[model samples]
Target: MADVEDVQVVVAHQERATVRVGEVFLKIDADQRRTDVEVEAMARAPIPTPQVLWRKPPVLALAGLPGSALGRLGEPPTSSPKAWSAAGAAVRTLHDAAPPPWPGRTLDEVASSLERECTWLLANDVLPADLVTRNRRIAEAALRPWTPVFMHGDLQVAHVFVDGDRVTGVVDWSEAGPGDGLYDLASLTLGHREHLGDVIAGYGAEVEVDVIRAWWSWRSLIAVRWLVEHGFDPAAPGCEVDVLRSQV
Candidate 1:
């Protein structure tokens, strides 16, 4: 093992933080349940994930994946379409497996949170009234019934790693559990609309394009306030705000 001489903060907030030391990542969380879920889900997932180095209460250490992340929110993906498709295929495999024993938020919970976030966004004047309203209407399409499948929960393009056209692994398992499959897909393609067709082509199944678009609106609408509070910029070019605007 390498010595921890140089440390880099991967991500940090009040709730949790992750730092990298050599090839190891130490994730410190405010909540243990999320860590528990992450461990179990990684152990159970059929696809590749970071190797668990060790766990000690608030900290869980994992080995880094071999390649770079699939893409970034505001940047064009340099990876080939085949790599994106491979990511979709890996997600399909994860979805097909049995779900984790713990449950995810129900539809009502999701709807309630969506309503609150939407209200906050409007009240704070975070975006134009028309932009919020149009996207809110589009979001309604995602509120309908959905069959539960094992979901990565936060399938950000940055979370999926790849080498050439091969998907090495996915990281960030704290949000993993049973949920709508399209939510993962929508999350991956949220700010990268041009890659949707490639991902769907890799998905290799019949999925409603409208439903994906709906989730896109719903995801972007609910994420603005949180991103701002967490020191992130959702309004940046090719980010969540742009995703919402594209819906119009």
Candidate 2:
């Protein structure tokens, strides 16, 4: 509470906004339940996470991690293969740990949303119908049942932080819970397929890579309209649109 001069707005949407004041990040959320889940999940996760400084209803303060993000959706990774491997290892650790008390999306729920989103895409002509159709077919493989594990339900690459070859911590834990582990894997490597092997190498190779690819399609396909609504460009190079196109 000293003389805080600089205030940086990190991200803002209708649902939430994150502002950074000095080294502390203040997350203002609309839903108290999501914030509750985030705090609890971070406490439960075996892997590194941000330190919770305080919480005041809509605003939660977290101490910033020590490293840059692993990468962004439409950007080339600055972290090395070793760092990506480290991230994968950390994810594996989280998956092996006992899950939280809360629930995550079921397979049926995911499939239903995919169907609705696909219909919206078609109606709006958001993408070429054939492209949508083809990726939808590819995405079908991910619709099957999975053994649940503790999932960082939105494991985007930007949420992971690293320094050199070491994973410093992960952030944005509102979506963490029991869910498909491969979904987490797919999310972390989305738009960054080249690093998948390095991740698998560290994670130990019981994974079905084709399933990972399928989830990639599924995730990208369902995400397009949401991105558009959220003022993000899914069609950006190396982003969600490119990810869907790369299915073949």
Candidate 3:
């Protein structure tokens, strides 16, 4: 093993912290259960994921995957549209695989959470009342029941790595479980609407664009509070707030 000298903070908050040391990543989380789920999900997933190097209570180590992330939130994707489509194809592969043994949030649970988040946003005056209300209504379209599939529950663009037009790997498996496939699609395309058609084309399935749009609203509305609480700026250009405002 190479000596770890260079360390970079990937993310840090009350719940967890992730740092990179050379080619290895060390994730520290107080809850072992989440780490357990992440390890198990990586083992079960059909798509590429970071290899687990080792684990210790409160810390899990993983070898780095090849290539860079697909893109970041609140920024234009540097990857070609073809790369985005490749990522879409990769997601489809994961969805087609056998479902994970664990369950994920049901549509009712999602709706309930959305409602609560909306209430909080309004109470906190996070945005204009009309803006929140309009987006909430749009979110309703995503509340309908869906047949569960193997989902990378947090398929944010930053979690997906690409090499040329091919998807090299996807990181962050703590949120993987049985969930709606569209949720993953929506998450991947959240702030990158221009790539939706390319992604869908590579998905190799008929998907309702309207439903995906609904999920965009649902996801953004629910995520803003969490991002704020966690010290991320969702108001940045091309981020969650902008995504919601773009709906108008």
What TM-score goes with each of the models? Answer: 0.97, 0.97, 0.97
lDDT of 1 by residue, 61-84 (tens): 999999999999999889899999
Residue-wise C-alpha lDDT for candidate 2, range 1-248, written one tens digit per residue: 46756999999878899999888999999999999999999999999999999999989999999989999999988889999899889999999999887778898998998899999999999999999999999899999999889999999999999988999999999998899899899999999999999888878758999889999999999899888998888999999999988886
Counting only residues 3 or more apart in sequence or on different chains, how many pairs clash (N, Cα, C under 3 Å) in candidate 1?
Answer: 0
Clashing pairs in 3: none
Q: Candidate 2: where is the Cα deviation over 4 Å?
A: 1-4
- For model 1, what is the C-alpha lDDT against the true structure? 0.91
Worst 10 residues of 1 by lDDT: 1-10
- In model 1, what is the error at residue 132, expressed in angstroms? 0.5
lDDT of 2: 0.92
How much is the lDDT of residue 142 in candidate 1? Answer: 87
Model 3 regions more than 4 Å off: 1-4
Give one digit per residue, the lDDT tens place, for model 3 in 1-248: 46648889999999999999889999999888889999999999888899999999899999998889999998778999999999989999999999989878887799899999999999999999999999999999998988999999999999999988889899888888999899899999999999999899889999988889999999999999998999998899999899999987
Ranking by lDDT: 2, 3, 1
List lDDT for all candidates, in order: 0.91, 0.92, 0.92
RMSD of 1: 1.6
